[model samples]
Target: EAAVTQSPRNKVTVTGGNVTLSCRQTNSHNYMYWYRQDTGHGLRLIHYSYGAGNLQIGDVPDGYKATRTTQEDFFLLLELASPSQTSLYFCASSDGDNQDTQYFGPGTRLLVL
Candidate 1:
C-alpha cells in the first residue's frame, strides 16, 4: 500500500511569516503534488513535480513554491505568508500509471494570524 507522511501536523504564524511543509511518500511514486484546502475553494493544487528537479506551478502560484528532492520526498514553501493563506495543506503522491491512484497525507493545519 502507498503511504504518505507530513511533519508538524499543526502550525501558527503571524502575518508575513514563513513556513515550510514537508512530505514523504513510501510508495516510490513518480508524481508528487502540493495542495491547500480552504472553504469555498475546496482543494486547489499549488504545485507539482513529475520527478526530481522538475516543478510545475498550479493555478494558485502567488505565494507558494514547491520542490521535489527525490522520488519519495516533496516540500512546500510559503514565503511571506499572509493571514489569507491560513488553511490545511496536503501532500499527495501517485505513480502516474493507468492503475495508479493518488495517496494523500494526513495534512498540516496552518493558522496565519
Candidate 2:
C-alpha cells in the first residue's frame, strides 16, 4: 500500500458542530484530496491540493474548509457540521497523474446527530 492513513477512524457530532478529519501520506505524492462516500452518491470530491499551501476546491466544497500544512499532511474542516455532511470520508494521494490510481487511506466515518 501507499501508506496513506487517517485519524480517528470514526467520529460523532451534533448539527452545527465542529470537526476536523486528518490525513497523512508518507508516499511523497504531490497531489492530495478529500472525498466523501454516501450510499447513493458514490464518491464526491470535497477538496484537494497540489502541494503544501496550494489548495484546490472540489465539486462539493460547501460547508467545508481545507488546509495543506505540508506535503505529507492534509486536513478537512467542518466548522458547522450538518446532518447532510455525515458520510465516509477518504483521503487520497497521487503523483499528479493518472489520478484514478490514487492511494487511499482507511477512511473516516462522520456522523452528525
Candidate 3:
C-alpha cells in the first residue's frame, strides 16, 4: 500500500482566500482520491484521478479544483475559498479500481473566517 501525505496539516484563511492543499503518494498508485469531512456529515468526495494530468470530478467538486501533476502528486486548489468550504480534507490512493482498500493520509484542516 502506498503512503499518502498532505502538507500544511492545518490552515486558517478568510473568506475569498486562495488556498492550495497538496497530497503526495510514496508509491506509484494508479488512482488517487480527495474528499472532505464536515462536522456532521460523512466523507464527501471532492475530486480524484486515475493518473497524471487526469482529473475526475467527485460529488462535491463545485468549490474545488484538483490536478494530478505526476503519478505521485495530486493537488487540491481553492482559488476563492468560502466559509462553507472549511472542513477536514483528506487524500487517498488505491492501486486498483476498487476503492475498498484505499490508503488515506492524515487530514488537512482548513478554517475560513
Per-prediction TM-score, please?
0.94, 0.96, 0.95
Candidate 3 residue 7 C-alpha distance from true site, Å: 0.5
**Best prediction by lDDT:** 2
- Residues 1-113, candidate 2: write the lDDT tens digits: 58999998999999999999999999899999999999988989999999999999999999999999999999999999999999999999998986357989999999999
lDDT of 1 by residue, 1-113 (tens): 88999987999999989899999999878999899999888999999988988999898878988888888889998888899889999999999885888899999999999
lDDT of 1: 0.91
Candidate 1 regions with alpha-carbon error over 4 angstroms: none
In terms of TM-score, the best-performing candidate is 2
Q: Give the Å error, residue 1, model 2.
A: 3.4
RMSD of 2: 1.0
Question: Which 10 successive residues of model 3 have the least lDDT summed?
Answer: 93-102
Encode model 3's per-residue lDDT on 26-112: one tens digit a residue: 988889999999868889999999999999999989989999999999999999999998899999999876645899999999999
Assess each prediction's global lDDT (C-alpha) against the native: 0.91, 0.96, 0.93
